[model samples]
Target: MQIALTKKLAEAVGVKAAFAQENENPLFSWTANWTKVWDNRRTEDMIVLVNNATRFTVAIYQVKKKDLKNLEVMMKKAISNTLLFMNINPEIVEEYMRLAGDVELVQNRGRQTAAWVSKAGLECSFYVGREYNGIEKMFCDTVGSLINYNHVNITKTRDEGFAPYQEMINALTELTGKPAYKYRAFELSATLNLDVYKAVRRIIVPANLSFERLHNVLQTVFNWKNYHLYDFAIHQGDKYDPAIRVVPNRECLEYDENAVLMEGHTLSEFLPEYKHILYTYDMGDNWEHEIELAQVIEDYDKESPFLVEAIGQTPPEDVGGVGGYVNFREIMLDPRNPEYKEMKEWARFWTPELSDWEKRPRVIRL
Candidate 1:
């Protein structure tokens, strides 16, 4: 299959193309600046053609009739890998796919093809067949069209699926305009409960912090081991209208399937609207914290999460949520109790003193 593709691609592009396995990187030096073509056969039985000068790549998947059911999956993997190889963000590719009107490529059949030009001027094409005639020309035409394509207009037209993301980006851009020396920061107090006896930690985090980063800050400030699953649920009014749940990739099944990814979104986007949020950590323990945005510091230039104040010690992780923590706390406070010494030692190890709080703010790197 790969040999045939190599021969056909060579014939169509009028260049000597060779069959290279997925892991193989063949060296080629060309005199022309914008006409270099490279071919590789992926381990998944797909042929990838990359033109370095044009910043264009094509993934050709030769599917058998029996494998038609898995064509969409194959195409997605191929496209994703191609984009990764081309140093393109999958999100941008997703936006392009949405604009191109065939995100899943489910309707693509034998010899069907799709092409998209990225915001960074990279052209990507997907072909579902062995036929290579005119494929090069198709890529060339797509690149030509891309040269004059209005990406912002395309984004506006296909703005339905990505409204929330776009809104978040716009809000962030507005908030962080011009990248001044100081950044807008959020002073948040995350309390385990509203009761007087509950554990509480006051933190000042950058407005651009993502939910994932918030999780890490909570873990560090509270001195809790990151051994459990967690999520953040935003609320409006009495009902939790729209929440951004951030769970470990493996534990996503535990929460609502429609939850937004916790990585891309920044705290600034949601904190301004929904000032109150519920952060649940260790699902089994049911440790819920009420995260309130106490204040927004406009002149703060810190890059990390800073612990301002802490009241009471964070319960030892896996202590079975609030109820278990209460029981454990009771046991630790009583020296006569059988678990007192062991539990106290455990608490001392995980809980940090007020002076021990690192002065450096925690920064979330994407």
Candidate 2:
């Protein structure tokens, strides 16, 4: 093992020097899929396991001698920074950080402390385990097993199915003291739609996570693809088959099985063409004319008041975004702006346009 790392270290130094200099000093010595070595006068190989795809196994090295106490502090900072970049939860990161002060330097038997000077110097190795059990395992075994056995419909009856999101929300609320109304529930409901969310929530949250706790977990794990928005993804053919199908809410109202279209179908499969069903929105001529026209409505002194009501309320600091008052001011003050115009278009596209009389100060009832 030591011989292999020595050879790999030579190769790594060669590669590093080639990048910008013919014989520049190597910053660190490492091997791919094996031990990393530190070299000065003597050499020490630090073995590391890199099989966990989601994390990096860091091998620290030094050319000069150092005491264990000083080394521990350096290792702690290095561990904290590395974990932060890997996007591990701050709480989990903190747990690992506490272990930093415990790292000890293995020393030779009968060697005096000062006599134990390292020619190759001090070495530290850390293996960062995967946070969410590697991608393949979670998808294939955990989620796959869920789909294989319970099926999507099971999401409704199973107590485990809907509980995680609630638990996470509850925990975050207790920790942050944020109000229920402060959260962006539309996003949370969207997260509950994914299978991975339930699995991770089980690991992170208490048995009964409140709304705030759920929000924090979502904020932490939003980068994972399983929690990505949209029910159907590019690779849903095998995974989302009815054999393993589950709805977002277990109580989800079913559409006519015959009326519902599956993976490969186009927009025509669901909606009629008269609805001007564009899979994506159009951008074309009179686009500027469309803008000028909206400005006219704003100038007439109509629609602005009710627009205020439709926006609901401002998002809290925890739920930062353009909310009711800000959006209303932006739209009314400059209705012709492209962004506000796009917002208006989306309102019409996603929901029906309210009639002048129908426009209430509060969100219009469905």
Best model per TM-score = 1
Over 65-96, each residue of candidate 2 has an lDDT whose tens digit, in order, gives: 32222433444444454333322344544543
Q: List the residue pairs that clash in candidate 1.
A: 304-361, 304-362, 305-361, 305-362
Question: Compared to the true structure, candidate 2 yields what TM-score?
Answer: 0.18
lDDT of 1 by residue, 1-366 (tens): 121122332333344444333331111100111121224432132334322112233343333234434433444444444433222333444453443243211111112111221222222222222224323322211122212112233434565233222332233234334222255778998888623276787888778766766787788776677787777788764425645555546458555677776756778888778878888888798787888889988877443366777777677777777777778767866789998888877766543223444443443221
Name the regions of candidate 2 deviating beyond 4 angstroms.
1-56, 61-69, 99-101, 105-366
Winner by lDDT: 1
